[model samples]
Target chain A: MERKWNKSSLMGWQFVALPSALILLFSFYPMFQSLLLSFQSGKGTVYHYVGIDNYIRLFSDPMFKQAVFNTLLYLIVQVPIMLLLGLVIAHLLNNPKLRFKGFYRTAIFLPCVTSLVSYAVLFKSIFAVDGILNKMLLSMHVIQEPIAWLMDPIWARVVIIAAITWRWTGYNMIFYLSAMQNIDPSIYEAASIDGASKTRQFFSITVPMLKPIILFTAIISTNGTLQLFDEVVNITKGGPGNATMTISQYIYNLSFVYTPNFGYAATVSYAIVVMVAVLALFQLKLGGEKR
Target chain B: MKKLTTMVVHLFLIVASVISLFPFVWMLMGMTNSSSEILKGKFSFGSMLMENIHKLLDMTSLGAAFWNSAIIAIIGTVGTLLLSSMAGYGFEIYHSKSKSRLFGLLMLSMMMPFAAVMIPLFRMFSGMGLLNTPTAVILPTITTAFMIFFFLQNTKSFPRELLQAGRVDGLSEWRLFTRIYMPTMKPTYAAAAIITFMNYWNSFLWPLIALQTQDKKTLPLVVSSLASSYNPDYGIIMVAIVITTLPSVLIFFLLQKQFVQGMLGSVK
Candidate 1:
């Protein structure tokens, strides 16, 4: 029996050995090296042990501060709005009496499947000076002229936020919709019989039941927004004087676009890591991971 | 009052669906319109579809870029599903204390932003003389922590009785895995394949840094360069965007049911 137990354990290791090795080599090793690299300052390859110099520079760097502020603004504004929109849409779609449910779900979910470059290109054109949005507004006489959506500081941020909300609301809706299915129907029946309206039922019943998923989506969206790079880089290019620049894009610019400051970039990356970790912890505490 | 509420719900859904689908319709129309017409917000189709396609093909090495993207996405997806599923199965079914701890550590690795480790990864790839190669892009992502977590989560639903039955039939462990476990997880594999393929295909940042040469560039990078050029033609750019977006959409259409089921399994 002991020999048999030993054989099964060996078999287990055999199954996992290759993948574990790959993860160690590619994921963990690079992570450890970056943590070490964060301490060493240099251009390109030349380096010395700087010991927290990069962290010190982070406070003084205006670009870094702006990127952090922009990222935080997105986190505060976009995530709640997107998640709320997702919840409302999911609740609406969950209505058993609703028509064309599959069609609506598919259309809403299609945006998440689109290639980032394709959507960024689409959004950029849609918000261009003579783009469809401005054209519509003009025909409606809402604005006398085209709003340069991607040119101005405030409008550019609005465009970025709108683009993200458009793409991800459906994604979060899927989570809510799926979780909502797990809810028992009799609870809603009881609520309805007890003089509850649909809106009231949604608030009291649907919201409480979907708490775990809400928390899950919240943390995931927070992490995603903190590392928001692709949209800003592709659409605005953090342009109009870096108005919409995000921390992830700043890190990209530091390493690839500008002179290779590996240490500083690594430090900025850690800031994101720390921020996400703290936010996730706080969410879990408030959401109360109750089964 | 009931009639009014239903009308309101339907109106909201119709508006949302139109908003979601408008970009696609506009893109298709733009493909058939001239550059200036697109800039002018022409809502109608024109006689420029073939002309735009010809111009796109003539100007860029789009065929090579498509091939590069297809190869990387296919290999990356297949590798990710097989290896991550293996580890997932091993950790779940085998049930070792140390292995679970290791799995927990792996999950933490998922939270580490890719940007944090990208510089070191790039340096390592450069040191290995793989800077301009697709291998550099494929290697780092081939065994993603998220995929492993996904598989691990899904494996909770996989029945252990089948494994015991396979063992009693005198099959080797690896044989049972390949012949029985893999075949039984078709829906899960289908879902993972679509998601992984989309990720690898639409992946921009790493591939942008890794594949420097024009011939080695993926479709996204190619489209980006075209869109950014001085005096960019919106018609040709729209064509490129359509081409890049088509594959993921096609895969999503084909495998969406399984994809949703897989997601349900994970969340449950």
Candidate 2:
């Protein structure tokens, strides 16, 4: 990039300046404004900075606590299961002798193309008390009667978990499949020569090699789940008594659904920012990214 | 034993594939059935397709919703590609310490969840008197850090020799970027375009907040509203959801390779 005029350094700014300005205006400026709003109190127009009262209120807020609990429940219960299932499927499809790899890949990956709201609505209908699932179970004698799936609190949570897992497992599988392809086949050959079983090879070689990707997907899924507004908002509407209410939904409720409390909602939103930062750092350390 | 193991693997894949593909099939079947028939677990096609389309058209402005989504997705995707790529090229090609620090700051923006910025953004847009408009929905996401990251990662593989030769040919920096750089990076642009379009198309939360009016509502918003009704007609919902989901599906199938490449670019 060295030039006679010493112009390249200044020239690069011309390209980047507009986009940098836009990101600053939309992303950073609003982020700071949100942070400022979190510290203020009162609704709509009349508001003033009230120290950390909003932060203190967050501790005692039942709805906020419930939302956090439901979000963590999804992250703990759904993420590992989805990632493991994705890894297993990717491993299976990575087999050279496996037939119809393209078909399987496409079929599984097809779910990713679906919009979150669309799939959530579809899953809701499918799991309704008198819907296709209950009908199938009844015909097969697996259940003696139709279960009101979205009515029960526990089952409603399960339905949300299932819906998220169903939509995203295949999406994660694509990542693992590509990463697995990069692993040297000769490494597996050597491990087999040394009498490592298929299961052993997967655990030792494949899992270890895909650590960074696992960490990546885990963080992405965690962030996504924490902001889990769409599925819950659409599927259950945070119903069965806020059983599946995520923090994002709570933010929406605070600002829009309920009386306008953008101040407190911004406070709640900051909680997510802190949690995301903390969890991502924790995953990076746990995944042993030093190597 | 090994043969049995392989058979079991095959069976497992079959079940997984069926589960993955079943809803799509169910949605298609639902398109052809009435609401109550679908409720009673009828899984076969019926003669209600035309009726459902008729009802959907009568109930909502389906055409307007589709048009809104198309406008937002197309314009937003094109703007995102251009702006993000320019920033990416500047950061990578220049390779300065100050630029790297600035890039790091921009990357931090990626971690700022939309919820955090939603309230302020709403206020900002409303203050500008741009509520219920496509610009509000399109502006915030037009130059995302994630898309910029994608371009930067892809740019690392770009050949520097071309830039040297172009410079020798008296090509200005912007002209070189336009004439030489863009043509060589068509695949990257395509990949970025596919992913960006799908994102804008499928985006719900921001658009839901920004676009408040009915006629201005995008397809996802319309489908969501339709299903949120007290006594939703499953037939109408089926039609709406199918219409909402089809564009991304078609784009995905058409440029499946670039879509995958674009996604992979993020992590790499």
- TM-score for each model: 0.97, 0.98
- Candidate 1, residue A251: CA error in Å? 0.9
Poorest 10 consecutive residues by lDDT, candidate 1 chain B: B259-268
Q: Which stretches of model 2 miss by more than 4 angstroms?
A: A1-6, A289-291
Question: Model 1 scores what on Cα lDDT?
Answer: 0.88
Query: Number of the top candidate by DockQ?
Result: 2
The whole-model lDDT of each prediction reads 0.88, 0.92
Every model: Cα RMSD to truth: 1.5, 1.2
Q: Label model 2 with its docking quality class.
A: high
Candidate whose TM-score is highest: 2
Estimate candidate 2's alpha-carbon lDDT, on a 0 to 1 scale.
0.92
Q: In model 2, how many backbone clashes occur?
A: 0
Give the Å error, residue A195, model 1. 0.7
Name the regions of candidate 1 deviating beyond 4 angstroms. Answer: A1-6, A289-291, B262-265
Candidate 1 per-residue C-alpha lDDT over A92-125 given as tens digits, one digit per residue, 9 for 90 to 100? 9998988999999999988988888888888888
